[model samples]
Target: MNWSWLGPPMDVRPLFPVERGAFLDLLNTLTAEDWERATVCPGWAVRDIAGHVLHDQVRRLSADRDGHPGPAFEPGEALPGYLARTNEDFVRTARQLSPRLLVGLLDRLGQELDAMWAGRDLHAPAGLDVSWADPGAPAPTWLDVAREYTEYWVHQQQIRDAVGRPGADGPRLLRPVIDAFLRALPHTLRDAAAAPGTAVTVTVPGPAGGRWTAVRGAERWGLAPAVPDGGRAAAEVELAADTLWRLASRGIEPAVARTRARLRGDEALTGAVLDIVSIIR
Candidate 1:
């Protein structure tokens, strides 16, 4: 399950065009009924998901490409709540747009997004932090872009699941998504009280999966591709790549993930691994 071929600091900028092309192709093949089908995103249908994707592109283009700032948080609002409210608000209003219009916008804006990403310096500080990965700290441009790829890929999978028209699940597409999501493992176990040198290894056993170990350091847990030399993992968790993606993205509940996952070693560490979520919610 270890991805020795693809090393750390995943550069997902190369993936944007391919994933976006696949997204548009998938949208064009949907039937009228398919647009109305329910997706794993609670209460959001296929069209809603499409509209959500459109909204994401528009917001990114405006903010990143055009340097336009987005709306500020309301009084007393939290990050997760603000994001949830704004996303739901957009999807609700977007329900009025025809499917054709949604796809058309995605086509145009997707190109802009791809271009924007192409011009970014991967080593520079990102516009915003990937909160789940390194909360309150500036993320590198590469990690930010990788997070964007995972978002688009996960939402596309949601649509495919609803309509039973799967595509873009190959190792090329999914491996980066899994790797990007695994960046959040350190933050996920941030509060866990573990002695230095303790390590937890998570393995997704499939073509698209790989191994990641989060080792406890003097002050924090750090995620890496391999465990340190002579260090044995204090806990290990194993699951399919499909389950890992869904679990990381909140497509499935942790209770459900626990049933599907195999656990060994410390219960608290394994439980923290199961609770790892890549999204704001």
Candidate 2:
């Protein structure tokens, strides 16, 4: 995933209005029982997931206020335990709010995020470590935020799915977010020891003709223009965009790559590709 190609580093402001609108629109249509349904995220119900999203937004503001990059849970911290605790806090805080109040909270959070990034220069430092839900890995701050958007967008889909609703507006709105996820690949590859110079191609089936080729070099990884060679890739692996997104987001077994991806070329290279793609998000 060559996320750097998503273009200039700007605040996530542009996504806010659209995201908020979608969130509100979705909320207005939900039944009370819809909030109790379980989400794909293990052990979290729909309301819990909603609370966590809102909680993360509040925490972002607090982190900004405290003059820290973000929370850094210590090594050996129990990932699920921490998530449960934080989620509990969020649900408690939001418990008093009606569905309309929850919508208002999300709207305000969106506005603040928009204002925070509006007309501001926010550059992610190289190799910044950020705590994530995964215990085995910590992500870069930029990737951390990118994952947040992915979560918001994907879970928005999950909410829709639970209610038998149609998909979000279209792929165009998600291109930038997808690009951000792709851009994090170098870090993901390096962390997984796949690095650059290992020849591999990742094909994401499209709405934007999604596909990418990442070649590992001596010093760094380079992303080439993605051109599918008519199913004749040197080392080809194909997956649906949603499956790739879920794999990247750590929602399922990384080994699912073997079953889901269509692979060809050296078996070792296939392993490398799996390793590289598995650790992202």
Candidate 3:
């Protein structure tokens, strides 16, 4: 079978500046009270989410634009633990800054990121691997940037959810987030045993929804955009776009999300899809 279709490059080049502008607009509208409200991220308030996004922006510019390396991991530090510690450290320290300063820095740094992204070749090797999606190799620049876009968007959504101001669920913003998260399917299903050519399909239904199928190869599973061979599969799952994103990001627990998922065919393959967590934590 031709495996080239797996994990196709998504050139979300124009989305960087647009997403940044929306993020800034969202942040500017928050009241001081809104900043203190709790979000879905456990023990993290709206202010912490804002601070986290700012850290993300700074880290990207430092690592990719300025060629500065990130902090070294402690000996025997796993990726998730190290990332969580660093993120919490940043958020804890960032509390000293006023909201106005945070917005101003984000506005300026976002412009820098937009400019840096505009000049890069999408097909070039990424500065960091999107380890959740494809740990075996460095991703293309497009996928890396798309993941960044999702980070900003997801944080913005958290803030919105906290403040009771819900916007930015449009297909343009959310569709890409869902698409990028689905890239984790192959890795999510890596341990599920299936014969060569066995297909597991996942479908998210809505304006921002799409279908992806992961086919068992000789040594691994490979994900492709569309279903294969008359849309048949050994397993298939249908879920809403909101559930899929939250499910893949650990924003919602597997048992809770499974309540929303409609499963058919093989139970094991469908269960594997439900267990997907696209982020490091």
What are the lDDT figures for the candidates, one per model?
Answer: 0.86, 0.60, 0.85
> Is 2 or 3 the stronger prediction by lDDT?
3
lDDT value, candidate 3, whole model: 0.85
Candidate 2 or 1, higher lDDT = 1
Please give the lDDT score for candidate 1: 0.86
Q: What would the per-residue lDDT of candidate 1 be over residues 1-281, giving only the tens digit for each residue?
A: 22221136678887888998899999999899999999887899999999888889988988888889888899999998988888889999999998888889888888888888889888778857788887777788888899889999999999999999878999999999988888888889998889988889999888888788988888778876577786678999998889999999988889999999999999999999999999987
Question: What TM-score, over all chains together, does every model reach?
Answer: 0.94, 0.76, 0.94
Model 3, 1-281: lDDT tens digits are 23253477787768877777887888888888988999998889998998998999898899888989888899999998988988999999889889999999888988888889899988888856788877857777887888888888888888888888888888988899999898888889999988988898888888898888888878888886555666589999998998988888788999999899899999999999999988877
Over the stretch 43-111, how does candidate 2's per-residue lDDT look in tens digits?
666666677678877876666534565445557766556666666766776766777778878888867
How well does candidate 3 match the true structure in TM-score terms? 0.94
Model 2 has an lDDT value of 0.60
Give per-residue lDDT, candidate 1, residue 260. Answer: 94
Question: Cα deviation in Å at residue 8, candidate 1?
Answer: 2.4
RMSD for all candidates, in order, please: 3.4, 4.8, 2.0
